[model samples]
Target: MSTAIASPRAFKADAAFLRGLGRAFAGALIFALPMLMTMEMWQLGFYMDPLRLALLLALTVPTLVGLSRFGGLRPTARLRDDVADALVVLLVAALAAAVTLYIFGILTPGMSAREIIGKIVLQTVPGSFGAMLARSQLGGEPEGEREKDPPTYWGELFLMGAGALFLSFNMAPTEEMVLIAYKMSAWQSAALALVSLGLMHAFVYTLNFRGGSARPDHIPAWSLFARFTLVGYAIVLGVSLFSLWVFGRTDGDSLKEILSASIVLGFPGAIGAASARLLL
Candidate 1:
């Protein structure tokens, strides 16, 4: 028991590998998304051009291999954890990336705060939920079992509040969903995903590592998941809202748009669910 608990992350578990994995997942989404949307499963001349995606995936391949070599970090997500966490991460990551771009736009003076956030959430929401459903369907587990283990309700309420507020306040003017399928540059979309993934994983792993690698340890407070959930969600939401209110409000954007647009960027987390999976 001591050995299991005390085991240190070995080989490829280092920061470089971690960063690379984050980047790969992000880049793959960017590369595959446009083509997938345009061409579907079949590759076509205009949409299915695979050069950049192939390159991006290739860039991370070595890192993925190295990371997996440590202990098979390949996505055993289904058996190990429900797909909700990933979706949550995906949504949060997208928002994070959007926020990054938002800051960038402040300096460049072209993109609207609302437009960027809206576009990001629009494309990201579907991908986030779709990824969840995709993994769940592929996972082949009974919905009943998954449903049976519903997360502690307190955590859910707080997180939902936090997530909703985060989304509504920070990402202003509500970006148009149309941007997801159109308008974004290849590099832009990939950058969006990559940065967001990095932010999400950093938040998660920091908590996990701080918590003694035990799911229970990761809880906000024993029998107080809601309290902690509210706090964590609150911090993130506050930062996002503040970021938008300051930088996002400069233009002719409507106040309603800014407020409505700020939502928790990722999937409303499965707090306890993530905790359980991290432990298992």
Candidate 2:
């Protein structure tokens, strides 16, 4: 009698794990397809600074762990479970990236191991994020099924940083960032900064976008702005700068050029940060 009951439970657990893996694969592909197909992304995989690439990949572990804590391919009950989920997400991301690159003819047998590994590893960053978010975005679970504990202040900031990084990573490899920066005058760059700030503020506070947070009745408007909006923008700018640097976009560029590029990328980054509650 004991074995009969145990077997069914075991089978159900295995089945659920398999379903989670399937969702992770789909999420990885759906989120990472843009970078997988981008020409600059392919080139950067092998030619960009190896240290930077490795560092980025290393940083991904913590990011995924944090993501698992908040929302992941499955509900995790403990820190150890979250870590395991993060690793599983990474594996799924790597496998998805490898298969997609193979289908695209970018991961040919003729390529050296270093080249093949580089391409897949570079793509896995975004893929992992997608895999982690798959549950929240694709699972379509009712709000009641999700975690009830509200995020703390630092947790909110971290999500904003993650969001900024995700959006910036997609655009950082493209040439348009630098091109637009080159074309714009100093005054235009400043104007764009103001616009980014205003739009970011509006998205979170004024526009009342779905998944946006409401300000506490006791908190003054300026206090909310200073604490959340301004701080979130700062995080977005930092993430944008880091993304640009990771892609070698800032190499040999003047300080002005770097700042201009960062500001340009910060536009999307700001939007991402403001929308983190919705997306992440």
Candidate 3:
């Protein structure tokens, strides 16, 4: 006699298991990505200037701890959620390039002080809302599905945005900010801003990853002490390149200056973000 096919309930169970496995895979990639970006920042800086690289390492501790405490809430959290935060940090690095380039007409002839002020105010609300909308859309879960958390959404956003923005800006002034602050043209500022944000995002993401679930056999090449070095480097390279292109600079000197600014620029966002992440 032929055996009976698996029942509907069995099929449903199998399909559910497969979906979970898919989610886990996606989550792992997302979780691992931030660490990759962070590694790139540290590696590139170390390759260029090891002493200053210490500062980047130093910044990671706080970011990881803070993220553990204050990052956006997820259903399972499961490291994948952490990855989303890190990616957004990376995206902000790209936005800095846009800001520096005046892609939104920031530096145009009509951008008087009043206009700038008005624009900043006008954009802040919408910009924040846009970010929230993006986050909500990315969640993909129905509104009813999200878990309940303490009511501190705005506070966390403020900390995340402020910390990332300040740190990145400090890492390297946008060529324009550098120019205006130190007298340089818009294009140059764009380049500087891109590198700075890229480094900052990389640094923070790594810090977040450091807090990731530690596995017993993460590496065997360095006898299990490698800490995802090559993977991290790969991430940083993309993070840096994405921002660098956004900044619009290909010059060796410009890139050098931007790299050097990483540690110094990372301070504020590091502190503020860490603090905010912790408190939130």
Instruction: Estimate, for each residue in 44-163, the C-alpha lDDT of model 3 and write its tens digit.
Output: 322323333234334433343334234332333556555554444334322432353255344367555544433332222212222322333244556455633542634344445434
Against the true structure, candidate 2 reaches a TM-score of 0.96
- Candidate 3 — which residues are off by over 4 angstroms? 1-49, 68-73, 76-137, 151-163, 166-175, 184-280
Candidates ranked, most accurate by TM-score first: 2, 3, 1
Model 2 lDDT per residue over 1-280, tens place: 5575569777897788888889889899888999999999999999989999999999999999998877887777888988999999999999999989999999887898889989999999999999998888887567557764778999999988988887888999899999999999999999988998898889988888887887779999999889998999899989999999999999999999999999999999999899988888
Q: RMSD of candidate 1 to the true fold?
A: 16.8
What lDDT is reached at residue 170 by model 3?
26
Can you give the TM-score per candidate against the true fold? 0.25, 0.96, 0.28
Cα-based lDDT at residue 50, candidate 1: 38
Clash counts for all predictions: 17, 0, 9
| Best model per lDDT | 2
**Can you list the residue pairs that collide in candidate 3?**
40-236, 170-265, 171-265, 174-189, 175-188, 175-189, 176-189, 179-183, 179-184
| Cα lDDT, all candidates | 0.35, 0.90, 0.37
Off by over 4 Å in 1: 1-133, 158-257, 260-280
